[model samples]
Target: MDFNRKEMDLLAIKIRKNILRTIASKGTGHVGGSLSIADTLAVLYGCVMNVDPADPGKKDRDLLVISKGHSGPAMYAALAARGYFDEGILDTLNKNNTILPSHTDRLKTPGVDMTTGSLGQGASLAAGAAFADQLNGSSNYTYLILGDGELEEGQVWEAALFTAHRRLTNLITFVDANGKQLDGPTDQVCSLGSIEKKFEAFGFHVISVENGNDTRQIYDAVMEARAEKELPSVIVLHTVKGAGVRKYAEMENCHSTTVNREELEAFYQELDAQADDGGKGTGKEA
Candidate 1:
């Protein structure tokens, strides 16, 4: 399951393209958050996670609970790409009868480990799951990804305390510190000053990766977190809202949008160009 930079880059490109296609089919969805987590999800699903598409509910399988559940499009894309379901299902996202809603639902989705969308509850659930695994003497690890905005909820801190107090070393949390929330920038909305320091104060080990789009750094950070036996780990990842697509990445209103046919065509064209750009399409812009 080891992934080189090239393979990781390709996975990111595929995930980004899948997201764009899904949004196009849905006509409206959460593009910004989904794109922001593409690289991190790529490294996890494409390489690190010990998940089996055939036995998604296996007792010893690694778990990935997307705390920022609005980013379900990305998770769905990654899971489908990883063979948990038919990739064609992505086009049905957000439809009335589609299992792929804007938020994840474990009951309906094959690869989803938790049904999360109520803000801060997902992190708490992830912690509980991790603690359960530890108590049962299972070697499985649980990974949680939280939005910076979601951290404003009081329950996130409560979960942090619980995870640290229990010393759930099998759990790893990643804060998508993309700065922007739904309405505005996180700093302006409610300053979560020094996120890493706050985690350290909660009796957990914390690491800050300046570039969230760097697959290698994310991989190393997660590996380091896994090696820690005494405490839970949090990695504060700096990211852009709409990451890979250039125009969307710069646009303020890219969080959720109506995807017209023309825009969808253009976006897919851009993604194809990115995939064909040799080493330049690796999600890093100069």
Candidate 2:
């Protein structure tokens, strides 16, 4: 339950690196969005979220539901880093008959609480889990992450409204507002005007983090959300579509980029150089 911001930053870097390597192993995956939420995932699974890797099924433990499940590579790296499963499993991502798949599958992945891939269903599922926990008098929170573009789905709003109406304070959602989406920038694709105002209008206690890639900022936002008592809280994370790695971040459209052998080698080489440069930064890519 205790976290050092510096340590969390390093963990996020490691997770992001693993995500790149994993997706590279398969020659393709959701590289952009996966990188976008790396810091947030590290803050959750590494800094916060009370759950035992050894006792993943324990009733009183906190749960995480990834609504934008295409970003599973990030979550998978986080889970493996936290010892939910062997780290080697990450290299097998999306391989035929492998536990790791294109999208998150609870039945398949060791630490995945809910299977999600249809874009907007995970929010509703997390809401249902939160409501059930509340009814059962459990002191656990159900955390959900959704992409900014995913918010275009009407189902997410319905779940948000329900969470607010029921006063499901135990449910906290993080919108990964990384600007761009599959087609292009979310504005050009399907403009979601003022994500913060929209969540606030849905009766959520909203907090806006200027830099979602900052572990300290992410952790602070979660703590603030945890302190809210009246309604569900939503933290709007302003992030780069492809975070951590500079080349990917600079891409205009990196929803899912193909990584050939040379690209992957160059990517890891940059990370190696950063490490050689002391890897001293706390936030943002080195």
Candidate 3:
């Protein structure tokens, strides 16, 4: 289903709402990181990715890996919104025997392409998947999303080097430069200086999208990346930790939180307002 700009915006808002609701239902989850990547996830599933909800295991289909798998709620919300499974399953997140764990699991989830929870491994897995597809002479692309904090992992840089060395044009990476992590601001924690330049130094074609929360911009960047034939592309997206809902976005400790019924209702209402206002849900409120 091809979504126009407005449709994509609404879908992203709905996905953000779903993420909030799911976390709220569970009483606790990664709200900040998950909410921050809602727009990017929305664009991928709603516009950029060539995925079939009914045939998720199609060999030639595009793959997406969430490297910072703590943000699994965002991916689950996106998959559910895309009709990969019944949306009702969202309420069972983090529950016993539930498929929706804190991280993605390909073995348990219909739309998940890889099992990812260990921060840096998912990037390597994504690069490997892209290389395998290349070996099989398939044109499908592999998309991987990583948290800015995840860059602290040496394995992520190793995978980046491997991807660039192989010239895996079928692979695209996005860094959710949300500035904050489980502890505090990434710069304050570990100081990953010049993310785009780091990827460029690793021989990747890098693009920095200031408004990563804009679905149109995200779609355009993905299209541009897909057109590149010589290098793996990296999009350094500047984002906020808790993006959509005003309360969480402003909170310093929004990374993970216990939500009450009132908080959940407010979050949904804010999402609805943002959708109605045609706001992209990334900008700071006045």
Candidate 4:
């Protein structure tokens, strides 16, 4: 797959649109965090990961585990963009018998590799998969994405230690440091001091992406992290809660909010206008 930055940008835009669609379908969902990770997910399912929508169960395929599984709408949007499933299914997000659940469930979704939503346990589960793959002599890499708020869980550090002790080089973790969580800002809730230093202390080669919302930077970060041989790698992405959209990003509680039908229609119009202006319809102004 020849990765073009412009195409990735378009995909990220589409994924963000899908996030809004999912939110509207359910009347409410994790809009902020979902939008925050759109660019990163676009890079992964679009170009970075070695995955096949056709052979989703292939043995050597790379795996993605969204640790902050509440952002499943973003992942679903990416998967749909990558041809994992029909894009039409995106509207069923969180609905009855909907495959697109609020959180990631591997068993229900076609391309989801891990069922997550228990906050901090996803990293450990991903590490365990990496360890088992190493034992089996498989070279597939397991990627895990977590929200900054999730760092408050003790299990994350425990998993980090385990990954380091075992030297799980095939495991790469990305922390979406969006700064805000469900309740409030991370600082007002529980300030995770020096996230990079803490991960480094846990034996991860920490790489910081100043702009986590940039597809090019996220792609580069993943490529750079893939080269680490001695220990696990973690990329901390400094991102806005509602990244692409200016209105949501500016909102204090965009973490999870309601978007009525009228607001949703306005958003699509906003996206189209941005696209016409040669920008990714992020609802942001210059």
Q: Best candidate per TM-score, number?
A: 3
Candidate 2 or 1, higher lDDT: 1
lDDT of each: 0.87, 0.86, 0.87, 0.87
Error of 1 at 15 (Å): 0.6
Residue 79 miss distance in model 3 (angstroms): 1.0
* Residue-by-residue lDDT tens digits, candidate 4, 1-286: 6678878878888888888887887789899999899888988888888899998898789989999999999999899888889988998998889999999999999999899999998998999999999999898999999899999999999999999999999999999998999899999999999899999998889999988888778888888898888878999999888877777988988988886756877776665565444344453321
Residue 16 displacement in candidate 1 (angstroms): 0.7
Residue 252 in candidate 4, Cα distance off native in Å: 0.4
lDDT of 2 by residue, 126-245 (tens): 999999999999999999999999999999999998999999999999999998888898899899999999999989999999988878788999999999998789999998877767
Q: Write the per-residue lDDT of candidate 1 for residues 3-97, one digit (tens) a residue.
A: 68778878887888888888889788898889989989999988888888899988778999998899999999898888889999999998888
Backbone clash tally (model 2): 0
TM-score head-to-head 3 vs 4, winner: 3
Q: What TM-score does prediction 1 earn?
A: 0.95
The digit string of per-residue lDDT tens for model 3 on 1-286 reads 5558888888988898889878877889898889889999989988888899999998678999999998999999999998999999999999999999999999988999899999999999999999998999998889999999999999999999899999999999999998888889887999999999899999999989887777777888888898888899999988877887777778987888876767777677777777756564434221
TM per candidate comes to: 0.95, 0.94, 0.96, 0.94
lDDT of 4 at 141: 92
- C-alpha displacement of 119 in model 3, angstroms? 0.8
Tell me the alpha-carbon RMSD of every candidate.
1.9, 2.4, 1.7, 2.1
**Shift of residue 93 alpha carbon in model 1, Å:** 0.9
